[model samples]
Target chain A: MKSLQELEEIRNKTRESVYLRKDRAGIRVVVGMATCGIAAGARPVLLAFLEEIKKRNIKNVTVTQTGCIGVCRLEPMVEVYLPNQEKVTYVNMTPDKVSKIVSDHIVNGQPVMKYTIGVDGR
Target chain B: MEDLSLHILDIVQNSISAMAETIRIAVMEDDTNDRLTVLVEDNGRGMTEETVKKALDPFYTTRTSRRVGLGLSLLGAAAEFCGGSLIINSQPGKGTSIEVWFPMSNIDRPPLGNMTDTIITLIVCNPDIDFIYEHSTPGGKFVFDTRLVRREVQDIPLGEPDILEWIRSYLSEGLNEIRGGA
Candidate 1:
Protein backbone atom coordinates (compact mmCIF):
# COMPACT_ATOMS: atom_id res chain seq x y z
CA MET A 1 0.00 0.00 0.00
CA LYS A 2 1.48 3.36 -1.09
CA SER A 3 1.12 6.55 0.95
CA LEU A 4 0.28 10.15 0.03
CA GLN A 5 2.52 11.84 2.61
CA GLU A 6 5.41 11.96 0.15
CA LEU A 7 3.22 13.14 -2.69
CA GLU A 8 1.96 16.03 -0.64
CA GLU A 9 5.49 16.91 0.40
CA ILE A 10 6.78 17.09 -3.17
CA ARG A 11 3.67 18.88 -4.43
CA ASN A 12 4.25 21.64 -1.89
CA LYS A 13 7.92 21.97 -2.76
CA THR A 14 7.46 21.90 -6.55
CA ARG A 15 4.25 23.93 -6.66
CA GLU A 16 6.05 27.23 -7.08
CA SER A 17 8.45 25.95 -9.75
CA VAL A 18 5.70 24.27 -11.75
CA TYR A 19 3.66 27.47 -11.63
CA LEU A 20 6.66 29.48 -12.81
CA ARG A 21 7.32 27.06 -15.65
CA LYS A 22 3.76 27.58 -16.88
CA ASP A 23 4.59 31.22 -17.63
CA ARG A 24 7.52 30.25 -19.84
CA ALA A 25 6.48 30.27 -23.49
CA GLY A 26 6.86 27.10 -25.53
CA ILE A 27 5.27 25.05 -28.31
CA ARG A 28 2.00 23.27 -27.49
CA VAL A 29 0.67 20.18 -29.22
CA VAL A 30 -3.05 19.76 -28.56
CA VAL A 31 -5.02 16.72 -29.65
CA GLY A 32 -8.80 16.67 -29.91
CA MET A 33 -10.16 13.90 -27.70
CA ALA A 34 -13.90 14.25 -27.62
CA THR A 35 -16.13 11.23 -28.29
CA CYS A 36 -15.89 11.80 -32.01
CA GLY A 37 -12.16 12.25 -31.88
CA ILE A 38 -11.64 9.11 -29.82
CA ALA A 39 -13.93 7.07 -32.05
CA ALA A 40 -11.84 8.20 -35.00
CA GLY A 41 -8.68 6.83 -33.40
CA ALA A 42 -7.35 9.94 -31.67
CA ARG A 43 -6.19 7.91 -28.68
CA PRO A 44 -3.54 6.07 -30.67
CA VAL A 45 -2.67 9.25 -32.54
CA LEU A 46 -2.21 11.12 -29.29
CA LEU A 47 -0.17 8.27 -27.85
CA ALA A 48 1.99 8.24 -30.96
CA PHE A 49 2.78 11.92 -30.64
CA LEU A 50 3.73 11.53 -26.99
CA GLU A 51 5.83 8.47 -27.80
CA GLU A 52 7.59 10.30 -30.61
CA ILE A 53 8.32 13.30 -28.42
CA LYS A 54 9.81 11.13 -25.72
CA LYS A 55 11.71 8.97 -28.24
CA ARG A 56 13.27 11.99 -29.85
CA ASN A 57 13.96 13.67 -26.51
CA ILE A 58 12.07 16.71 -27.69
CA LYS A 59 12.11 19.50 -25.11
CA ASN A 60 10.27 22.75 -24.52
CA VAL A 61 7.18 21.34 -26.25
CA THR A 62 4.09 20.42 -24.27
CA VAL A 63 1.62 17.84 -25.54
CA THR A 64 -1.92 17.79 -24.20
CA GLN A 65 -5.45 16.72 -25.09
CA THR A 66 -8.44 18.96 -25.73
CA GLY A 67 -12.15 18.08 -25.82
CA CYS A 68 -12.76 18.92 -29.42
CA ILE A 69 -11.67 21.22 -32.23
CA GLY A 70 -15.25 21.63 -33.64
CA VAL A 71 -14.52 19.70 -36.83
CA CYS A 72 -15.68 16.24 -35.93
CA ARG A 73 -15.68 15.39 -39.60
CA LEU A 74 -11.95 15.86 -39.57
CA GLU A 75 -11.43 14.05 -36.34
CA PRO A 76 -8.13 12.95 -34.83
CA MET A 77 -7.23 16.55 -35.46
CA VAL A 78 -4.05 17.86 -33.93
CA GLU A 79 -3.21 21.50 -33.49
CA VAL A 80 0.28 22.89 -33.09
CA TYR A 81 0.81 26.29 -31.47
CA LEU A 82 4.30 27.69 -31.76
CA PRO A 83 5.28 30.67 -29.68
CA ASN A 84 4.53 33.95 -31.49
CA GLN A 85 3.20 32.02 -34.46
CA GLU A 86 -0.16 31.13 -35.97
CA LYS A 87 -1.93 27.96 -34.86
CA VAL A 88 -1.75 25.16 -37.43
CA THR A 89 -4.47 22.54 -37.43
CA TYR A 90 -3.78 19.10 -38.88
CA VAL A 91 -6.72 16.89 -39.65
CA ASN A 92 -7.25 13.14 -40.08
CA MET A 93 -4.04 12.40 -38.23
CA THR A 94 -2.56 8.90 -38.19
CA PRO A 95 0.39 7.66 -36.18
CA ASP A 96 2.58 7.74 -39.28
CA LYS A 97 1.45 11.29 -40.02
CA VAL A 98 2.20 12.21 -36.43
CA SER A 99 5.74 10.91 -36.85
CA LYS A 100 6.22 13.12 -39.90
CA ILE A 101 4.79 16.13 -38.08
CA VAL A 102 7.14 15.52 -35.20
CA SER A 103 10.12 15.44 -37.48
CA ASP A 104 9.15 18.11 -40.03
CA HIS A 105 7.32 20.59 -37.79
CA ILE A 106 8.26 19.93 -34.19
CA VAL A 107 11.89 19.07 -34.76
CA ASN A 108 12.87 21.02 -37.89
CA GLY A 109 10.57 24.02 -37.31
CA GLN A 110 8.84 23.54 -40.66
CA PRO A 111 5.11 22.82 -40.70
CA VAL A 112 4.21 19.82 -42.84
CA MET A 113 2.13 21.74 -45.39
CA LYS A 114 0.48 18.75 -47.05
CA TYR A 115 -0.84 17.40 -43.80
CA THR A 116 -2.25 20.72 -42.67
CA ILE A 117 -6.03 21.25 -42.85
CA GLY A 118 -5.39 24.13 -45.24
CA VAL A 119 -3.92 21.78 -47.80
CA ASP A 120 -5.71 18.49 -47.04
CA GLY A 121 -9.15 20.15 -47.21
CA ARG A 122 -10.84 17.11 -45.71
CA MET B 1 -16.55 1.87 -26.13
CA GLU B 2 -15.16 -1.56 -27.01
CA ASP B 3 -14.03 -2.18 -23.45
CA LEU B 4 -14.52 -0.80 -19.96
CA SER B 5 -11.13 0.88 -20.05
CA LEU B 6 -12.11 2.91 -23.09
CA HIS B 7 -15.29 3.96 -21.33
CA ILE B 8 -13.23 4.91 -18.32
CA LEU B 9 -10.99 6.98 -20.55
CA ASP B 10 -13.97 8.69 -22.14
CA ILE B 11 -15.80 9.48 -18.90
CA VAL B 12 -12.65 10.68 -17.19
CA GLN B 13 -12.36 13.26 -19.92
CA ASN B 14 -15.53 14.80 -18.56
CA SER B 15 -13.92 15.22 -15.17
CA ILE B 16 -10.83 16.72 -16.74
CA SER B 17 -12.96 19.15 -18.72
CA ALA B 18 -14.77 20.10 -15.53
CA MET B 19 -11.43 21.22 -14.07
CA ALA B 20 -11.10 18.46 -11.52
CA GLU B 21 -8.01 18.55 -9.35
CA THR B 22 -8.36 15.06 -8.02
CA ILE B 23 -9.99 12.12 -9.76
CA ARG B 24 -10.62 8.71 -8.23
CA ILE B 25 -11.40 5.61 -10.29
CA ALA B 26 -12.29 2.36 -8.60
CA VAL B 27 -12.94 -1.03 -10.14
CA MET B 28 -14.40 -3.81 -8.06
CA GLU B 29 -14.54 -7.31 -9.50
CA ASP B 30 -16.32 -9.87 -7.36
CA ASP B 31 -16.67 -13.18 -9.10
CA THR B 32 -18.34 -14.81 -6.15
CA ASN B 33 -21.04 -12.14 -6.04
CA ASP B 34 -21.13 -11.94 -9.83
CA ARG B 35 -20.85 -8.17 -9.73
CA LEU B 36 -18.40 -5.68 -11.15
CA THR B 37 -18.64 -2.05 -10.25
CA VAL B 38 -16.75 0.95 -11.57
CA LEU B 39 -16.82 4.26 -9.80
CA VAL B 40 -15.34 7.46 -11.22
CA GLU B 41 -15.42 10.33 -8.76
CA ASP B 42 -13.98 13.76 -9.40
CA ASN B 43 -13.55 16.95 -7.45
CA GLY B 44 -14.57 19.21 -10.29
CA ARG B 45 -17.33 21.66 -11.09
CA GLY B 46 -20.53 19.76 -10.45
CA MET B 47 -23.50 19.91 -12.72
CA THR B 48 -26.96 21.22 -12.00
CA GLU B 49 -29.94 18.93 -11.36
CA GLU B 50 -31.30 19.51 -14.85
CA THR B 51 -27.91 18.87 -16.40
CA VAL B 52 -27.59 15.66 -14.46
CA LYS B 53 -30.99 14.48 -15.66
CA LYS B 54 -30.15 15.36 -19.23
CA ALA B 55 -26.71 13.80 -19.02
CA LEU B 56 -27.94 10.34 -19.95
CA ASP B 57 -29.89 11.58 -22.89
CA PRO B 58 -27.92 10.94 -26.06
CA PHE B 59 -29.38 14.05 -27.69
CA TYR B 60 -28.34 16.36 -24.86
CA THR B 61 -24.94 18.00 -24.88
CA THR B 62 -23.24 21.22 -23.83
CA ARG B 63 -21.02 21.40 -26.86
CA THR B 64 -21.96 23.79 -29.64
CA SER B 65 -20.48 21.83 -32.51
CA ARG B 66 -22.26 18.58 -31.62
CA ARG B 67 -25.59 17.75 -30.08
CA VAL B 68 -24.85 14.28 -28.81
CA GLY B 69 -23.25 13.31 -25.51
CA LEU B 70 -22.86 9.60 -26.05
CA GLY B 71 -20.34 8.88 -23.30
CA LEU B 72 -22.79 8.59 -20.44
CA SER B 73 -25.63 7.36 -22.60
CA LEU B 74 -23.59 4.55 -24.01
CA LEU B 75 -22.32 3.54 -20.61
CA GLY B 76 -25.82 3.70 -19.19
CA ALA B 77 -27.16 1.54 -21.96
CA ALA B 78 -24.40 -0.97 -21.48
CA ALA B 79 -25.01 -1.19 -17.76
CA GLU B 80 -28.71 -1.71 -18.27
CA PHE B 81 -28.03 -4.33 -20.88
CA CYS B 82 -25.87 -6.22 -18.41
CA GLY B 83 -28.60 -6.37 -15.75
CA GLY B 84 -26.93 -3.50 -13.95
CA SER B 85 -27.47 0.22 -13.53
CA LEU B 86 -25.69 3.56 -13.74
CA ILE B 87 -26.04 6.43 -11.31
CA ILE B 88 -24.76 10.00 -11.42
CA ASN B 89 -24.49 12.07 -8.27
CA SER B 90 -23.63 15.74 -8.46
CA GLN B 91 -24.04 19.04 -6.68
CA PRO B 92 -23.15 22.38 -8.13
CA GLY B 93 -19.54 23.36 -7.36
CA LYS B 94 -19.06 20.23 -5.28
CA GLY B 95 -18.17 17.57 -7.90
CA THR B 96 -19.61 14.62 -9.81
CA SER B 97 -19.38 10.93 -9.13
CA ILE B 98 -20.58 8.24 -11.52
CA GLU B 99 -21.22 4.71 -10.35
CA VAL B 100 -21.78 1.90 -12.83
CA TRP B 101 -22.59 -1.68 -11.96
CA PHE B 102 -22.54 -4.71 -14.24
CA PRO B 103 -23.10 -8.40 -13.84
CA MET B 104 -19.85 -10.28 -13.74
CA SER B 105 -21.29 -13.29 -15.55
CA ASN B 106 -23.20 -11.29 -18.10
CA ILE B 107 -22.12 -12.20 -21.60
CA ASP B 108 -22.82 -8.68 -22.84
CA ARG B 109 -20.65 -7.11 -20.18
CA PRO B 110 -17.59 -5.53 -21.67
CA PRO B 111 -14.23 -6.77 -20.64
CA LEU B 112 -12.11 -4.67 -18.34
CA GLY B 113 -9.58 -3.85 -21.00
CA ASN B 114 -5.98 -2.76 -20.63
CA MET B 115 -6.29 -0.59 -17.55
CA THR B 116 -2.52 -0.12 -17.48
CA ASP B 117 -2.68 1.73 -20.77
CA THR B 118 -5.69 3.77 -19.70
CA ILE B 119 -4.15 4.93 -16.43
CA ILE B 120 -0.80 5.63 -18.00
CA THR B 121 -2.34 7.63 -20.83
CA LEU B 122 -4.51 9.66 -18.45
CA ILE B 123 -1.63 10.48 -16.12
CA VAL B 124 0.83 11.22 -18.88
CA CYS B 125 -1.57 13.46 -20.76
CA ASN B 126 -2.98 15.24 -17.70
CA PRO B 127 0.09 15.54 -15.53
CA ASP B 128 -1.31 18.26 -13.28
CA ILE B 129 -4.26 16.25 -12.00
CA ASP B 130 -3.84 13.70 -9.23
CA PHE B 131 -5.38 10.29 -9.88
CA ILE B 132 -6.20 7.54 -7.39
CA TYR B 133 -7.07 4.19 -8.94
CA GLU B 134 -8.33 1.34 -6.75
CA HIS B 135 -8.81 -2.22 -7.97
CA SER B 136 -10.44 -4.64 -5.58
CA THR B 137 -11.13 -8.33 -6.01
CA PRO B 138 -11.99 -11.09 -3.59
CA GLY B 139 -8.34 -12.02 -3.46
CA GLY B 140 -6.99 -8.58 -2.57
CA LYS B 141 -6.84 -4.89 -3.46
CA PHE B 142 -4.39 -2.61 -5.26
CA VAL B 143 -4.32 1.14 -5.11
CA PHE B 144 -2.13 3.52 -7.13
CA ASP B 145 -2.06 7.19 -6.34
CA THR B 146 -0.19 9.69 -8.49
CA ARG B 147 0.28 12.05 -5.55
CA LEU B 148 2.89 9.66 -4.13
CA VAL B 149 4.61 9.36 -7.47
CA ARG B 150 4.64 13.13 -7.81
CA ARG B 151 6.44 13.30 -4.49
CA GLU B 152 8.95 10.70 -5.61
CA VAL B 153 9.81 12.60 -8.77
CA GLN B 154 9.40 16.09 -7.23
CA ASP B 155 10.83 18.09 -10.12
CA ILE B 156 10.48 15.62 -12.98
CA PRO B 157 7.20 15.78 -14.87
CA LEU B 158 5.03 12.65 -14.68
CA GLY B 159 4.67 12.72 -18.46
CA GLU B 160 8.37 12.15 -18.96
CA PRO B 161 9.00 8.96 -20.96
CA ASP B 162 10.96 7.25 -18.22
CA ILE B 163 8.36 8.07 -15.60
CA LEU B 164 5.43 7.06 -17.79
CA GLU B 165 7.05 3.76 -18.67
CA TRP B 166 7.85 3.13 -15.04
CA ILE B 167 4.28 3.89 -14.01
CA ARG B 168 2.94 1.55 -16.68
CA SER B 169 5.00 -1.36 -15.38
CA TYR B 170 4.23 -0.45 -11.79
CA LEU B 171 0.49 -0.60 -12.46
CA SER B 172 0.64 -3.87 -14.42
CA GLU B 173 2.91 -5.54 -11.87
CA GLY B 174 0.97 -4.19 -8.93
CA LEU B 175 -2.31 -5.45 -10.31
CA ASN B 176 -0.84 -8.82 -11.18
CA GLU B 177 0.66 -9.20 -7.72
CA ILE B 178 -2.59 -8.36 -6.03
CA ARG B 179 -4.42 -10.81 -8.29
CA GLY B 180 -1.85 -13.48 -7.35
CA GLY B 181 -0.57 -13.90 -10.87
CA ALA B 182 3.05 -14.51 -11.84
Candidate 2:
Protein backbone atom coordinates (compact mmCIF):
# COMPACT_ATOMS: atom_id res chain seq x y z
CA MET A 1 0.00 0.00 0.00
CA LYS A 2 1.21 3.46 -0.88
CA SER A 3 0.32 6.42 1.30
CA LEU A 4 -1.73 9.22 -0.18
CA GLN A 5 1.36 11.36 0.18
CA GLU A 6 3.48 8.87 -1.69
CA LEU A 7 0.87 8.56 -4.38
CA GLU A 8 0.75 12.35 -4.53
CA GLU A 9 4.50 12.42 -4.90
CA ILE A 10 4.30 9.90 -7.69
CA ARG A 11 1.65 12.07 -9.33
CA ASN A 12 3.70 15.21 -8.83
CA LYS A 13 6.80 13.58 -10.22
CA THR A 14 4.85 12.33 -13.16
CA ARG A 15 3.53 15.81 -13.82
CA GLU A 16 6.83 17.61 -13.38
CA SER A 17 9.21 15.17 -15.02
CA VAL A 18 7.00 13.20 -17.40
CA TYR A 19 5.55 14.95 -20.40
CA LEU A 20 2.15 16.39 -19.55
CA ARG A 21 -0.14 15.68 -22.46
CA LYS A 22 -2.68 18.35 -23.32
CA ASP A 23 -5.41 15.68 -23.27
CA ARG A 24 -4.11 14.56 -26.66
CA ALA A 25 -0.39 13.83 -26.32
CA GLY A 26 1.96 11.17 -24.95
CA ILE A 27 1.69 7.41 -25.40
CA ARG A 28 -1.22 6.30 -23.23
CA VAL A 29 -2.55 2.85 -22.60
CA VAL A 30 -6.07 2.86 -21.20
CA VAL A 31 -7.41 -0.44 -19.92
CA GLY A 32 -11.06 -0.96 -19.05
CA MET A 33 -11.57 -1.59 -15.34
CA ALA A 34 -15.28 -1.49 -14.58
CA THR A 35 -17.22 -4.45 -13.16
CA CYS A 36 -17.56 -6.14 -16.51
CA GLY A 37 -13.88 -5.67 -17.20
CA ILE A 38 -12.92 -7.07 -13.83
CA ALA A 39 -15.22 -10.04 -14.38
CA ALA A 40 -13.56 -10.61 -17.72
CA GLY A 41 -10.06 -10.41 -16.27
CA ALA A 42 -8.83 -6.89 -16.94
CA ARG A 43 -6.65 -6.43 -13.85
CA PRO A 44 -3.81 -8.54 -15.18
CA VAL A 45 -3.92 -6.70 -18.48
CA LEU A 46 -3.61 -3.42 -16.60
CA LEU A 47 -0.87 -4.84 -14.39
CA ALA A 48 1.12 -6.05 -17.38
CA PHE A 49 1.56 -2.48 -18.52
CA LEU A 50 2.50 -1.25 -15.09
CA GLU A 51 5.01 -4.03 -14.64
CA GLU A 52 6.49 -3.55 -18.09
CA ILE A 53 6.77 0.20 -17.67
CA LYS A 54 8.53 -0.29 -14.36
CA LYS A 55 10.71 -3.12 -15.59
CA ARG A 56 11.70 -1.47 -18.85
CA ASN A 57 11.96 1.83 -16.96
CA ILE A 58 9.91 3.67 -19.56
CA LYS A 59 9.07 7.12 -18.22
CA ASN A 60 7.19 8.78 -21.05
CA VAL A 61 4.14 6.48 -21.05
CA THR A 62 1.25 6.55 -18.56
CA VAL A 63 -1.24 3.77 -17.99
CA THR A 64 -4.77 4.47 -16.80
CA GLN A 65 -8.19 2.84 -16.55
CA THR A 66 -11.64 3.82 -17.74
CA GLY A 67 -15.02 2.36 -16.91
CA CYS A 68 -17.28 0.44 -19.29
CA ILE A 69 -15.75 1.28 -22.64
CA GLY A 70 -19.04 0.15 -24.29
CA VAL A 71 -17.30 -2.96 -25.52
CA CYS A 72 -18.74 -5.54 -23.18
CA ARG A 73 -17.91 -8.36 -25.57
CA LEU A 74 -14.36 -7.14 -25.47
CA GLU A 75 -14.37 -6.58 -21.77
CA PRO A 76 -10.63 -6.86 -21.27
CA MET A 77 -9.96 -4.20 -23.87
CA VAL A 78 -7.24 -1.56 -24.03
CA GLU A 79 -6.80 1.45 -26.24
CA VAL A 80 -3.35 2.65 -27.20
CA TYR A 81 -2.93 6.43 -27.37
CA LEU A 82 -0.19 7.47 -29.79
CA PRO A 83 0.13 11.13 -30.49
CA ASN A 84 -1.57 12.28 -33.74
CA GLN A 85 -2.63 8.72 -34.48
CA GLU A 86 -5.95 6.91 -34.04
CA LYS A 87 -6.69 5.47 -30.63
CA VAL A 88 -6.25 1.83 -31.58
CA THR A 89 -8.46 -0.46 -29.53
CA TYR A 90 -7.29 -3.98 -28.78
CA VAL A 91 -9.50 -6.77 -27.46
CA ASN A 92 -9.13 -10.03 -25.56
CA MET A 93 -5.65 -9.14 -24.31
CA THR A 94 -3.83 -11.28 -21.85
CA PRO A 95 -1.04 -9.90 -19.68
CA ASP A 96 1.40 -11.39 -22.16
CA LYS A 97 -0.12 -9.36 -24.96
CA VAL A 98 0.34 -6.26 -22.85
CA SER A 99 4.00 -7.11 -22.54
CA LYS A 100 4.30 -7.60 -26.25
CA ILE A 101 2.59 -4.28 -26.90
CA VAL A 102 4.95 -2.53 -24.57
CA SER A 103 8.08 -4.04 -26.03
CA ASP A 104 7.08 -3.96 -29.69
CA HIS A 105 5.05 -0.78 -29.88
CA ILE A 106 5.75 1.58 -27.02
CA VAL A 107 9.44 0.85 -26.77
CA ASN A 108 10.40 -0.07 -30.31
CA GLY A 109 7.93 2.29 -32.01
CA GLN A 110 6.50 -0.58 -34.03
CA PRO A 111 2.81 -1.09 -33.28
CA VAL A 112 1.86 -4.75 -33.15
CA MET A 113 -0.16 -4.89 -36.34
CA LYS A 114 -1.59 -8.32 -35.57
CA TYR A 115 -3.11 -7.31 -32.24
CA THR A 116 -4.55 -4.00 -33.28
CA ILE A 117 -8.31 -3.60 -33.73
CA GLY A 118 -7.99 -2.74 -37.39
CA VAL A 119 -6.01 -5.89 -38.03
CA ASP A 120 -8.46 -8.08 -36.08
CA GLY A 121 -10.43 -8.69 -39.33
CA ARG A 122 -13.60 -7.70 -37.41
CA MET B 1 -11.86 -11.25 -9.49
CA GLU B 2 -8.90 -11.64 -11.82
CA ASP B 3 -6.69 -9.94 -9.30
CA LEU B 4 -6.00 -12.65 -6.73
CA SER B 5 -5.88 -10.15 -3.87
CA LEU B 6 -9.21 -8.65 -4.90
CA HIS B 7 -10.84 -12.06 -4.63
CA ILE B 8 -9.44 -12.45 -1.13
CA LEU B 9 -10.75 -9.00 -0.23
CA ASP B 10 -14.17 -9.82 -1.68
CA ILE B 11 -14.57 -12.89 0.51
CA VAL B 12 -13.72 -10.88 3.61
CA GLN B 13 -16.18 -8.22 2.50
CA ASN B 14 -18.94 -10.83 2.57
CA SER B 15 -17.97 -11.80 6.09
CA ILE B 16 -18.22 -8.16 7.09
CA SER B 17 -21.68 -7.93 5.55
CA ALA B 18 -22.68 -11.08 7.42
CA MET B 19 -22.61 -9.20 10.72
CA ALA B 20 -19.02 -9.74 11.68
CA GLU B 21 -17.91 -7.14 14.20
CA THR B 22 -14.35 -8.39 14.41
CA ILE B 23 -12.40 -9.82 11.50
CA ARG B 24 -8.76 -10.78 11.51
CA ILE B 25 -6.73 -11.06 8.34
CA ALA B 26 -3.22 -12.51 8.22
CA VAL B 27 -0.66 -12.52 5.44
CA MET B 28 2.43 -14.55 6.18
CA GLU B 29 5.53 -15.02 4.09
CA ASP B 30 7.14 -18.25 5.19
CA ASP B 31 10.31 -17.78 3.23
CA THR B 32 11.91 -20.58 5.25
CA ASN B 33 9.34 -22.95 3.69
CA ASP B 34 9.07 -20.90 0.48
CA ARG B 35 5.35 -20.24 0.76
CA LEU B 36 2.91 -17.37 1.13
CA THR B 37 -0.32 -17.90 3.02
CA VAL B 38 -3.39 -15.71 3.51
CA LEU B 39 -5.95 -16.26 6.23
CA VAL B 40 -9.21 -14.41 6.81
CA GLU B 41 -11.09 -15.23 9.98
CA ASP B 42 -14.44 -13.67 10.84
CA ASN B 43 -16.72 -14.06 13.83
CA GLY B 44 -19.77 -13.57 11.69
CA ARG B 45 -22.86 -15.44 10.59
CA GLY B 46 -21.53 -18.77 9.48
CA MET B 47 -23.39 -20.88 6.98
CA THR B 48 -24.44 -24.51 6.82
CA GLU B 49 -22.21 -27.12 5.25
CA GLU B 50 -24.37 -27.13 2.15
CA THR B 51 -24.05 -23.35 1.71
CA VAL B 52 -20.32 -23.53 2.27
CA LYS B 53 -20.05 -26.20 -0.41
CA LYS B 54 -22.22 -24.18 -2.76
CA ALA B 55 -20.27 -21.02 -2.24
CA LEU B 56 -17.32 -22.49 -4.14
CA ASP B 57 -19.36 -22.92 -7.25
CA PRO B 58 -19.38 -20.06 -9.71
CA PHE B 59 -23.19 -20.13 -9.88
CA TYR B 60 -23.89 -19.94 -6.16
CA THR B 61 -24.66 -16.42 -5.05
CA THR B 62 -26.95 -14.79 -2.47
CA ARG B 63 -27.57 -11.80 -4.71
CA THR B 64 -29.99 -11.93 -7.66
CA SER B 65 -28.11 -9.52 -9.82
CA ARG B 66 -26.57 -12.17 -12.04
CA ARG B 67 -26.46 -15.89 -12.75
CA VAL B 68 -22.85 -16.39 -11.77
CA GLY B 69 -20.48 -15.43 -9.00
CA LEU B 70 -16.78 -16.00 -9.63
CA GLY B 71 -15.11 -14.48 -6.59
CA LEU B 72 -14.59 -17.74 -4.73
CA SER B 73 -14.07 -19.77 -7.86
CA LEU B 74 -11.40 -17.39 -9.04
CA LEU B 75 -9.64 -17.50 -5.71
CA GLY B 76 -9.71 -21.27 -5.84
CA ALA B 77 -8.27 -21.23 -9.33
CA ALA B 78 -5.57 -18.76 -8.35
CA ALA B 79 -4.50 -20.88 -5.41
CA GLU B 80 -4.35 -24.04 -7.50
CA PHE B 81 -2.48 -22.25 -10.25
CA CYS B 82 0.09 -21.21 -7.70
CA GLY B 83 0.54 -24.87 -6.68
CA GLY B 84 -1.47 -24.33 -3.50
CA SER B 85 -5.05 -24.66 -2.33
CA LEU B 86 -7.86 -22.60 -0.83
CA ILE B 87 -9.64 -23.87 2.28
CA ILE B 88 -12.93 -22.80 3.83
CA ASN B 89 -14.14 -23.79 7.28
CA SER B 90 -17.36 -22.65 8.84
CA GLN B 91 -19.61 -23.53 11.73
CA PRO B 92 -23.20 -22.38 11.56
CA GLY B 93 -23.98 -19.59 14.04
CA LYS B 94 -20.33 -19.48 15.06
CA GLY B 95 -17.99 -18.06 12.42
CA THR B 96 -16.13 -18.61 9.15
CA SER B 97 -12.49 -19.01 8.17
CA ILE B 98 -10.77 -18.91 4.79
CA GLU B 99 -7.19 -19.67 3.88
CA VAL B 100 -5.43 -19.31 0.53
CA TRP B 101 -1.92 -20.60 0.02
CA PHE B 102 0.55 -19.85 -2.77
CA PRO B 103 3.98 -20.94 -3.77
CA MET B 104 6.32 -18.01 -3.48
CA SER B 105 8.18 -18.97 -6.65
CA ASN B 106 5.24 -19.62 -8.93
CA ILE B 107 5.69 -17.75 -12.18
CA ASP B 108 2.04 -17.31 -13.18
CA ARG B 109 0.82 -16.18 -9.80
CA PRO B 110 -0.09 -12.50 -9.82
CA PRO B 111 1.41 -9.98 -7.48
CA LEU B 112 -0.52 -9.26 -4.30
CA GLY B 113 -0.86 -5.70 -5.49
CA ASN B 114 -1.54 -2.96 -2.88
CA MET B 115 -3.29 -4.69 0.00
CA THR B 116 -3.17 -1.30 1.60
CA ASP B 117 -5.78 -0.39 -1.00
CA THR B 118 -7.84 -3.49 -0.25
CA ILE B 119 -8.01 -2.81 3.46
CA ILE B 120 -8.73 0.85 2.90
CA THR B 121 -11.53 0.03 0.47
CA LEU B 122 -13.10 -2.42 2.91
CA ILE B 123 -12.86 0.03 5.79
CA VAL B 124 -14.23 2.92 3.78
CA CYS B 125 -17.15 1.04 2.22
CA ASN B 126 -18.19 -0.89 5.30
CA PRO B 127 -17.94 1.71 8.03
CA ASP B 128 -19.51 -0.57 10.62
CA ILE B 129 -17.54 -3.70 9.76
CA ASP B 130 -14.46 -3.65 11.91
CA PHE B 131 -11.20 -5.07 10.56
CA ILE B 132 -8.03 -6.33 12.19
CA TYR B 133 -5.41 -6.97 9.52
CA GLU B 134 -2.03 -8.49 10.35
CA HIS B 135 0.88 -9.18 8.04
CA SER B 136 3.98 -11.02 9.19
CA THR B 137 7.27 -12.01 7.64
CA PRO B 138 10.39 -13.69 8.95
CA GLY B 139 11.50 -10.29 10.21
CA GLY B 140 8.40 -8.46 11.54
CA LYS B 141 4.63 -7.84 11.76
CA PHE B 142 2.01 -5.11 11.15
CA VAL B 143 -1.47 -4.95 12.65
CA PHE B 144 -4.49 -2.64 12.43
CA ASP B 145 -7.89 -2.61 14.14
CA THR B 146 -10.69 -0.14 13.61
CA ARG B 147 -12.39 -0.81 16.91
CA LEU B 148 -9.34 0.61 18.62
CA VAL B 149 -9.80 3.77 16.63
CA ARG B 150 -13.51 3.77 17.40
CA ARG B 151 -12.61 3.56 21.09
CA GLU B 152 -11.51 7.17 20.79
CA VAL B 153 -13.98 8.57 18.27
CA GLN B 154 -16.92 6.90 19.98
CA ASP B 155 -18.48 5.49 16.82
CA ILE B 156 -17.29 7.85 14.16
CA PRO B 157 -17.94 6.27 10.78
CA LEU B 158 -14.87 4.98 8.94
CA GLY B 159 -16.45 6.11 5.67
CA GLU B 160 -15.74 9.75 6.39
CA PRO B 161 -13.22 10.95 3.79
CA ASP B 162 -10.71 12.25 6.28
CA ILE B 163 -10.80 9.17 8.49
CA LEU B 164 -10.67 6.89 5.50
CA GLU B 165 -7.57 8.66 4.26
CA TRP B 166 -6.08 8.37 7.73
CA ILE B 167 -6.69 4.63 7.82
CA ARG B 168 -5.13 4.26 4.39
CA SER B 169 -2.05 6.25 5.38
CA TYR B 170 -1.78 4.31 8.59
CA LEU B 171 -1.77 1.08 6.61
CA SER B 172 0.88 2.44 4.25
CA GLU B 173 3.11 3.50 7.15
CA GLY B 174 2.60 0.26 9.02
CA LEU B 175 3.24 -1.84 5.95
CA ASN B 176 6.37 0.17 5.22
CA GLU B 177 7.53 -0.54 8.75
CA ILE B 178 7.01 -4.25 8.20
CA ARG B 179 8.36 -4.33 4.65
CA GLY B 180 10.83 -1.85 3.23
CA GLY B 181 8.11 -0.61 0.86
CA ALA B 182 4.33 -0.33 1.19
B110 Cα displacement, candidate 1 (Å): 2.0
- Model 2 lDDT tens row, B1-182: 54556666667756765688788888998888878899999999998999899988888877665666666777888889779988899998899998988897788777777787667655644567778889987768988887766654443345433455567678888888877564
* Each candidate: RMSD: 3.6, 9.9
- TM per candidate comes to 0.86, 0.60
**Which stretches of candidate 2 lie above 4 Å from their native place?**
A1-122
For every candidate, give the share of true A-B contacts it also has.
0.28, 0.07
Score candidate 1 by DockQ: 0.30
lDDT of 2 by residue, A1-122 (tens): 53344434333444433323334346888876544666687666765676677677665675666655776676688888877777878887788888889988887777888887677636
DockQ of each: 0.30, 0.06
Structural RMSD, model 2: 9.9
Model 2 share of native interface contacts: 0.07
Docking class of 1: acceptable
TM-score of chain B of each: 0.97, 0.91
What TM-score does prediction 1 earn?
Answer: 0.86
